[model samples]
Target: MLTDPTMWRPAGEMHRCLTDGGSAFTEIFGTPFFDHFARDAETAAVFHDGMAAMSEPENEPIAEAYDFPPTGTVVDVGGGHGGLLVEVLRRRPGLHGSSATRRTS
Candidate 1:
């Protein structure tokens, strides 16, 4: 649903004219993405879990592609499960920092 073009479809008087962002989706769904997500707990959990799962496959190549400072601090903002952070720090060594978005129950 995220790249749904119809969500941003233009309407009358909006023929290539810009308007407030809400005007885009409001005409169709009456609510925006964030609002919808917040209102639905199951959907929110799915989105969060999906995002966390996506990080694992990218960790190896990402670590291989970049050469982090041999010794310093590194932080992944939403470093889900610490997969990428662990790979990077393992490769670089001696780096220290904290992930602000650590998951906790």
Candidate 2:
């Protein structure tokens, strides 16, 4: 998505987007990025895959740094693949957690 020419157009025309009351992506694609993403399963998968890959390194550190309460629910919003939550719950055995999103085959 970042490599797409249309994605770059938004950077160049950010002021126009700000004044026109639309996102930089909407100005270029005639729709919001999420709208486009929702319509294209392949793109959505790629985006999610990228996010999950990028999040891998961060999850370990986050899980290590935080101190979760012994008996409470931890919620991860947009927790694709549940990597972060899994690590967190793994470290804190008694702390239950829920991921907002689940991986799909």
Candidate 3:
């Protein structure tokens, strides 16, 4: 869905997320974008996967270069699907982690 131009072209036309009623996502979806993404199982999966895929590459350099402390818990704030956390944990076996992201029921 994200790959489709039809889905997002309207945002440019609509001036999204810039003015008071400016959220094109909210306007189009009739809900907060994240909430709308989470409303369906398949869509939520695609959303998280896309987010993880987009973010994972950016996280690799940080994970590789960072010199973690010998012991303690690492928190991956907004760590969608734990990809970055997994990489960090794989690199530092002694470290533990917590991932925080949206909760869906």
Candidate 4:
């Protein structure tokens, strides 16, 4: 969707369009982005797999680039599955972290 022409429109216009109930995702896929995922389990799985594959390569680099305090808690809000937090905790022995997001039953 990043490469979609509609996504490249001016920010203000896009926001206005979205506010008016227009969706670039709906235009391309006949549903809003997340709705498309909800409607297609296979596609959602593939998309998540792709994201995990992409995140793995960056985790080590991200872990090394940052310096955490010797002992403190790091909260990764909305970080899916806590991959980065796990890496960070691995590298920083005394640091603690949590990946948290609200989930509906």
Model 1, runs deviating above 4 Å: 1-19, 22-42, 102-105
lDDT per residue for candidate 1 within 1-105, as digits (tens), equals 223343335344364337444455455556654465567657656656666676778888999899788788898886646788888877876888667663333
| lDDT score for candidate 3 against the true structure | 0.74
Please report, in order, the local distance difference test score of every candidate based on alpha carbons.
Answer: 0.64, 0.79, 0.74, 0.69
Give the poorly placed runs of model 3, Cα more than 4 Å off: 4-10, 13-16, 19-21
lDDT for residue 46 in candidate 2, whole number 0-100: 74
Clash pairs, model 2 backbone = none
Model 1 residue 34 CA deviation in Å:
7.0
Residues 1-105, model 2: lDDT tens digits: 455554567788888867877688876778776677777778777777777888999999999998778888999988977899999988999889987764333
**Whose lDDT is higher: candidate 1's or candidate 4's?**
4
Best by lDDT: 2
Tell me each candidate's TM-score. Answer: 0.55, 0.76, 0.76, 0.61
What lDDT tens digits, residue by residue, belong to model 3 across residues 11-95?
Answer: 5756445555566766666776667767766776776777787887877788888988867899987787888888889888889
**Residue 13 accuracy (lDDT) in model 1:** 31
lDDT score for candidate 2 against the true structure: 0.79
